[model samples]
Target: MGQAMAGAYLDRGYAVTLWNRTASRADALVAHGAVLAPSAAAALEAGELVVLSLTDYAAVYAVLEPAAGALKGRTIVNLSSDTPEKTRAGAEWFAGHGAVQLTGGVTVSPAGVGQEESVILYSGPRAVFDRHRAALDVLAGVADHRGEDPGLAALLYQINMGIFWTAMLSYWQAIALAEANGLSATDILPFATDTSDSLAGFFTFYAGRIDAGDHTGDVDRLAMGAASVDHVLHTMADAGVDTTLPATVAALFERGMAAGYGADSFSRVMELIRAS
Candidate 1:
């Protein structure tokens, strides 16, 4: 994610300083006119606006701890895959140490960086964001302010990961089930790709219904959908395929059926999946 954002900043003519604990990682960026910060302190001293994209919360502190004095009055932009609590803690840590920090999420892959298709998100002082807006735009066309909470960006990021994960899982799971029926990867690739592409729109549209807590049978009714899923399970089992994913879905459907939602839409089963 850091590489993606950095590539964008470089593309947009923003002077970006690059660094990695593994120095070799910066070689490509350095070739692209990004000056390497020799050490953590040098990196902080090198730029007033610094961005840290590391592995986790612990790594954040490890990098900053060595450069505490160098960070005075600087701005820190962190775009790590961290939880919300970690984001809040890191933001507060930077504030206590005299840096104006911003928590951010990058929604684009490395290839999407510097293009309009990617989005970079921020959460912190709106005033600070306004001041830095021009520089941020170099990374993506859509750099958004989420809210006052520094954790909102990461929260959104994790939710997005769920969409990606389940989509990928659905594809692989379908392929696995088909392989049991003598379908090779090549045979299933086209259909899997096209079908998953079609289903991709469902997350967004269905998510609205899920969030609104509306189980109105807008598309397919629950009982009918459950019947279709039952077919999938039976096919998998008859072909000696493992039923882990379908089994979980069946569990949810069974719970929904018990709750008298068997006649409702498939999305009404969201209640069965909720923590409560």
Candidate 2:
């Protein structure tokens, strides 16, 4: 991702200074007119706007702390992946060194780096964001400032990632179920995609239900839902597949029944889970 970002600036006619833990990866960029830094400190010394694309927030901290003095009066844009707490912590660390800091979550891979479609989030001082907007745009080309929280970008990224992971897991399970019934995944994909889209629409409805604390079941009762869960667990167990997931769901339903919510909604499980 770092190399990709650096390539964007080079293409945009900005002088690029590149460095990495493994110097070999940067060899190609140096050949493309990017200046090679002998050390992390030297990397920041080369530019007023120092950008970091690291493994995580911790890695960013490790690299930047040793170059603290080198960052005096400089602006550091951290595009490393991390939790909101970590992003806030990282920003504070940089601020203590008298350096302006911005933390963001890059939402695209290497191929999207220089494209106008790529999205990068900025969360820090609006003034600092406005100052370096031009340089940042060279990489993302579509960066948005997410207020002064310095953590909203990371928080939003995690929420986005949650949607991805859950959907991916559900899709994999659907694929496995289809294959189990002697149907090819290719044959099921188009309709499965449409089904997933319909199911995803429930998130908004559920969000309203959650906010209103109204998990009343009208059509989808808990015990009625448990019938499907039982079928799933039995089928998975019978097919020698991993039964952990369906088993867990079955357990939740059993708990809900014991709580006398068998006639309530499936989402009522949240009440028990949140109970102290």
Top candidate (lDDT): 2
| lDDT for each residue of candidate 2 in 1-276, tens digit (9 for 90 to 100) | 999999888888889988899999988889989999999999989988988899897788788778788988889888898999988888888888888888778888899998988898888899999998888888876898989999998898887887777778767776777778788889899988898789768887788887888879885789988888899889877766666666887998889988999888899988877759
Q: For residues 113-138, write the lDDT of model 1, one tens digit per residue.
A: 77877798899888888888887777
Best by TM-score: 1
Model 2 misplacement above 4 A: 272-276
lDDT of 2: 0.85
Q: Which ten residues in a row have the lowest lDDT in candidate 1?
A: 108-117
- lDDT, candidate 1, at 185: 81
lDDT of 2 at 186: 100
Q: Candidates' lDDT values, in order?
A: 0.83, 0.85
Question: For each predicted model, how many residue pairs clash, with residues at least 3 apart or on different chains?
Answer: 1, 0
| TM-score (C-alpha, index-matched) for candidate 1 | 0.88
Model 1, which residues run further than 4 Å from truth?
200-212, 217-219
TM-score of each: 0.88, 0.88
